[model samples]
Target chain A: MHHLRTALLGVCLLSPLGAHAYSVYVSSEKDNSITVVDGETLEVRQVVPVGQRPRGIALSKDGESLYVCTSDEDHIEVLDLKSLKVDHTLPSGPDPELLALGPQGRFLYVANEDDNMVTVVDVDKRTKVIEIQVGVEPEGMGVSPDGKWLVNTSETTNMAHFIDLSTHEVVGNVLVDQRPRVAQFTPDSRQVWVSSEIGGTVSVIDVAKREKVHVITFAIPGMRKELIQPVGIRITDDGSRAFIALGPAARVAVVDTKTFEVEKYLLVGQRVWNLAFAPDQSRMFTTNGVSNDMSVVDMERLKVLKSIPVGRLPWGVVVGP
Target chain B: MNPAMSRSSDWIRILASLSLILSIGLVRAEPLSIPIGLISAERAEYIPLSSLEPRIEDEGLEGARQGILDNNTTGRFTGQSFDLLPVTLTSDQSPSDVVRDLIQRGVRLFLVDLPAADLLELADLPEAGDALLFNIGAMDDDLRTQGCRSNLLHTVPSRAMRADALAQYLAWKRWMRWFLVVGPLPEDRAFGAAIERAAKRFGAKIVVQKPWTFKAGASRTDSGHFNEQQLANSFTQVEDYDILLVADEADAFGAYLNYRTYRPRPIGGTQGLVATAWSGVTEQWGATQFQRRFLERTGRFMTPRDYAAWLAVRSIGEAATRTQTGEVSRLRQYLLGPDFKLAAFKGVPLSFRDWNGQMRQPILIVSPRILVSVSPQEGFLHQFSTLDTLGYDRPETECSIR
Candidate 1:
């Protein structure tokens, strides 16, 4: 009887339908909902109604809770991952757009775009810890891998401010291209990358020196310079390649991390805003804000395998098991 | 050593390290202040014709003030600060003397809000040799064409650009024939010339051209409103045309022709549907925040002059931040350099045309209520950039300034 049961389990694991093990959650800015997709199969499982103006999203460190920045409501909604429901609300400052998790998920750094401040929330206590004043129209938030520094990018100010985690104070600020929308820390925590939407350049900052070390520019055949706006940046966990979503250009540029050169531009959906990776890093998904769908790309072949309809004006995406 | 004494010594060591780190941080942050000058000739008090038009008190100065605040926000992070030195000269005061005094006071970047003639006088001053002058008020096409100055960059669109912007929209709408009405003013005649030039360039036919000689009615009272309709009706009776284009730079009888024109043709050019560099109706491309901030700051709407002045100051601020210096020559070179682009809440990054020193931007076509369209319209292409299609392209420019 044990041999027969083991053989049956092995057969089930080899089947195609059994490969859907991951889930992708996307925040829709217009529809005010979170669309959940079966990561592997590219199927929409549910469209969970969220707060007003759901934009930036991030999963908890343990992947058990999801936080959605409801910019219109001026609050962060904590959604229960297991039950797929709003567990509670955390206090965010005015007009929260994007957020990042501090070291060990101890603090949630939320960028209040209108107020020009970053609201640091104590995740476990569900309380507002502090608000650090930053530059004008702060949008992007990034925490170093070691959790020692938090970087906030302001659009109008055209700068990336580095806040010390221990002191919760800004220790340094690095200027970048115009209207930087997102900042990402490499997995190894040696460098920080920022994508400027209007400037059309990605600035790589040396973490220790706190200055721009390199600037990556993108060019696509037959595309105008104004349309090649670099918005979302995601460096793979292995630190070998970085994927950047060029907003309004409808393409993603895959850059080699070691060489700092653009290897290829993968055509995606229109006005892509953000991207997420499967837990195993074998697949990637991009939220197309204008097209109202998500493009699922196969990492191995560097091709968009399918696009699944999600919600209106999808802004951000995050994946979990 | 004794245990208690050793513990006290360790405390002192820790405190020493803390103070050392704090001192290093302080030494690293040396703030630099960049002083900018605002030069404008004092104007007579502007009185509106009616209550419908709100009197703008701080037209150009308020915009510069707001721009200073914006620059400082970024400057605080970059260890740089911007200071505005505004000097409004009286009619009797010499612009050369004022500019020399400013240079003595260590001011290099200037925002000049003066008429075309006064601007040329200021630009010709020897004391203004090292200063980078930004023209935010003058709209004369000659300043951008044959009379262009190397040191001056005009933020305000030239008359030709505005005329071309309107002409492109009309062409896109297939309104190929136009009836032109010129007002009774020298500036109005200049605008009329620009309109005719734009029509010729855009392949439009001016079926008939006439001058508006009707006396403007004082429509502030009930009796005045009674004769306004009749006066406007008689003023607009012209030959067959698709659109009635008016050149009323004086704003005398433009508003009255909106609903009172014969044949019910849509009015454009200086009234009704108009093309402007900036408008209060625009809310796209993250401009709502700017509008809200301006409203909160001044308790009034932003005018075109205010927007132009703001952009002038912002250009200086952006150049200063990028070059990391307040030196006038360096900032000027960076501005005219090919890599210079300023994101001024427009969909596209704005840059200066090297030939004419005019900032190339997409003009907004607005109705009274909402923004209708943005020009440099579809199918209007340039060899380099679509923005070049709006104004005098490189080949057509006659500017001799180097």
Candidate 2:
């Protein structure tokens, strides 16, 4: 499927403007480094040292700079893609765990895990636009495809807060499973999937109704139910399939988007934390925290192709061209 | 029939039909009320010389209250309503009597924060045979071993668990040489024995063992600072050791050992780098959220006992959510079964040890200002769970109850 998507994307986007190599960037929590891996060869390209306690990573729309959340320093550092150096810092509120950029890449929404607020930064102005108070320990941030709403999931509050982009206010709040870690909006913006690490379930919320539509639970053969903690979620561009990173189970569960049923579980490295897809969508990279490595999964084969060793406690991954 | 009488009868008929439909809807959507009972002593006696420790009027009860709020928040969507029936007993009152009253009132789930003897008294009642009790205050290992009850689940970490957790960190640091200093109490001696067992289990050595006979002097008073340094330094004179592991369950003379010892060694076990369930300094793995919630609710930091109690109540809520029933028997069976797991901000899903009914979790080792580490340290592997390495595993269990 991934190969087909890449082929289709190549045929549709084949031009001089589309010719660019892809690289996967991973944030290592303990080692304080962002490891760069070539998307095609699956090799370590470079290891760039960043600030203290770097956990979340996001790339600019044009792929010129990478925004890294240095949680301990209570700020977000921008790394120049060409120089591979942190050139500037954004004043994100205390303890930013994860972040999401607006569709147009004008504003950056950061989840301040320690402060329980979402800091929206106007990227062009290089200033914080607003700090919206949210539920306790807001960690996951997601923006709708249409750029109308942003979703923030609070860990202890157990609610998915929907903030309207225009008003910068929480428009709707949907109660989800316990300890929601990641929220991902569907490509159509009709639904949002929030992964609950402690509840061991994924809550799919209907955006229009602002309520939970389905609760997807993963069950792996010979694995304990508690170990099936769903953390990172990624939906295919066409909204046909979803991949969920099961934290301690060390596997990625593939679910059919239409039916909401789990199709397969692919074994990965130890303590998988987050997932990212290559620009071409032909492969997925997973940060395995315990194994201190990243697993490359072939999207078409639905199998782990290789595990490349990274920094200590690899947390989040992002792919850019 | 008269025209006026017929018009009035038509209006009455419409009103009667609407009322019947509304009554049916109410019956169909009736919420399931799950009542949990909390029993603890009315007052917590303050320990002298600890000026930094604030006087918390309600520690365990406040934590359970927060848990109740959390449960109701999630339970609102699941059609479950959780109610906490907190019954505080005076020193003169009998704990078993309260247990009987709560059982009669339809509270089959309980969180008890009493001493070991009082907890046993409540658990051994005939009327409470079917009740599920959660031990949140007592850290006695016997409760999980020989004295384990079929109906009681201990959320508190046993002394052996803490000892093992600290031992793993010490062993990982290559601090194999320990100077064991025990206080003058029976419980302290038992804790000393647990430390000894941990040293043997983790391949460490207790270079010297001694008991502190000096009385705990008063703090911030006359003669309080007099002879304390001399006494502690004289008592700590022994073979060179990497750390001084104190077994002071009574809180007597342990705090004095820090900075007053003859040799410069890090004090651990009961002081300095102590292993606990929750610490004020732990901000990782989303604990900041819990700490913030707790601080907002109670206006203070959450203690270990409070976290244990909170976990106990949340366990019931999680079980109810999973089973979708408030029936005590079904919930008990499901919780004791191998399938039950609760997420309590410990970075892992916490579950019960089926053999001993002890909640298996990661013990946080913290100093005064920062979180030192969490143990069942690296390279300590178990065939089943790494958390089982900190406590009594299946093979080491004397608990016969399934």
Candidate 3:
């Protein structure tokens, strides 16, 4: 069934409208390159080589440039969308693994896995604004939609630190679970979902109270409990649904926001690490590290469309016009 | 003259009382400091057979230090602080005296990296009655059974657990036949006995069992390779078997028997493929970042002993973080309670056994350079946890910790 849909999509891409289709950019950690895939055709467009170990990629708010975290080289490489070439480098403190752009897209919050600090860099100026000290081994970064807060999840400390934008200090902290890999705020900015990779649970924290409101656990029949590691999390723009990427389980759990219950599991590639949605929210793309491919999901149907081979150890993804 | 002098002294006493009251209020406003003591003894260093292996001066101490750093990171937000006070015993120093001094200093949590005898001596001290000791070095099975103490908890895996872990994997591979080779040392014999128990429990047969009595000479000399090769070949010539199960914990001849066995069988015991709590080759389940952090901090690969020491300190940190107290009684209750579970880079949460005070954890079946599998291998299940299958279960435990 998926192969037939992929074949139909390929046929549709041959139309004239597909020439102006949006592009999906994926960061490959092992290949140290950015794979450009045509959104309309679900085909590989280009494999632009970048710096060493690119894991996190973020699209600018203006949708003109892509910021790729070259973790091993301890810097962020800026790739111009037009030329698909390396433009410049931002000073990321040390071993930047994942990053999040602020709501206005002026400052980029980079999580330095080695130094346990979040480096906020000015994209326009190409300089570091400040380094906010956080817990040990910070990996995940998220910014509130209202531009009032930045949440960083430390893998070792197992806490989501709420950094006040005005003061640049950790105003509050919520202890979630072990080895939190992602901190994602809801569209309404009232709650944040933190994924614990080892604890195998997702904790929902109330933004106002800075306290955990609910804990979401997953249980799959005939599957070992340890393999249900929750990593990447994405909530729809309407805040009605959520998609959680279960690492090494090869499944993405579809959760309803209202009841906070899992509705279904969509099978994806192996070791799915992160995911991103298209501009219209009609489709989703996931980076599967072990399989070296990206699984495209038809969001409306809640089914996997196809898996497109990309590069070795694909870690992060972002869609751009 | 006497009246004036007495009036001045009365004013001084009142002023001192006022200052004491203000200082008490200030101290109460500060964060509570929890100091944990780490006691270990120096031993004669033995050179490893492989030059790639590093000779570390602070094997377990570095792990304890890393644990303290990790605890402090969490403590920053919790409004608590942790400190590690370590003492390395010399040739003439006694462990009991050190325990007494630490107890007097009001340290209630201790991580001891000593042999079973010295660990028991410190646990028996009257001054340590209110203190809790974590064994991070000893792996003797007796310490978990008949020699258990009420106040002592073991973070290190026992020999029986390691043996069972290996046996389960071997059984899964259907390697039923075995040629067992035991070393001459007492520790080797104890390990060999555990292997025997595991073979019986897991439904494997030992085809031929023999003791290795060869005395190895200087291994770095020009003629060392020839002599060692001949010794391993002659010692391993036995009846037909699937694999050679060796018990050489002292590292005397196990490494030499890797490819020198007469029957061309695989080695599975303490040498070629071993079961341990932790190894450098283990990098899954978020252990890669942990290995990187440890390497950047200590410039050495983490050993099993280091991991045990780290687990000991992290266990206390987990307890104190949950209970928010430095009091001995409260932390002890919290650690042993059902609410306690530690995330130590393993795939699952590790907890202590109520019957024996031994920790329940998954054993890593690793070769020297890669991880083969983790046991409590699939299909080996217990009524409670699958980890219970790797060690002494509750019904089989002889320990009665009150």
Give lDDT tens digits, candidate 2, residues B131-162: 89999998988888788888899999999999
Looking at candidate 1, what is the lDDT of residue A304?
93
Candidate 3: where is the Cα deviation over 4 Å?
Answer: A1-15, A46-48, A290-293, B1-28, B172-174, B400-402
Q: Is the docking of candidate 3 incorrect, acceptable, medium or high quality?
A: acceptable
RMSD of every candidate to native, in Å, equals 7.3, 9.0, 8.2
In terms of docking quality, how is candidate 2 classified? incorrect
How displaced is residue B135 in candidate 3, in Å?
A: 0.9
CA shift of A127, model 2, Å? 12
- For model 2, the superposed segments whose C-alpha errors exceed 4 Å read A1-178, A184-230, A235-272, A283-316, B1-30, B48-50, B395-398
- Cα lDDT tens digits, model 3, B1-402, are 598898999888556433433432322446689999999998798787777777778988988888998998887667668999999999899998888988898888999999899999999998888899999998898998789898899999999999999999999999999889899998999899999999999999999999988877557788888988887888777789998989999888888888988878899899888999999999876687788889988889898888998998888888887787888888878888876778887777788988778999999999999999999988997767788998778777788784
**lDDT for each candidate structure:** 0.86, 0.86, 0.87
Across residues B230-347, which tens digit of lDDT does each residue of candidate 1 receive? Answer: 8777767777799988999877888788788877888989888899988889987768677878887788878888888988888888898899888888988888887777878777
What TM value does chain A in model 1 reach? Answer: 0.94
Ten residues in a row with the worst lDDT in model 2 chain B? B19-28
Could you give the interface RMSD of candidate 1 in angstroms? Answer: 3.8
Model 1 has an lDDT value of: 0.86
Question: Candidate 2 residues A1-321, lDDT tens each?
Answer: 233346435644663653346778999999999999878777788999999999999988667789999988989999998899999999898888899999887799999976668999987888999998676678889999899999999876677988889988775677677789999999899999999998899999999988798999888876766678899999988889999999889999999998999999999999899998876678999999999999999999898999999999999899875
lDDT of model 1 at position B375:
88
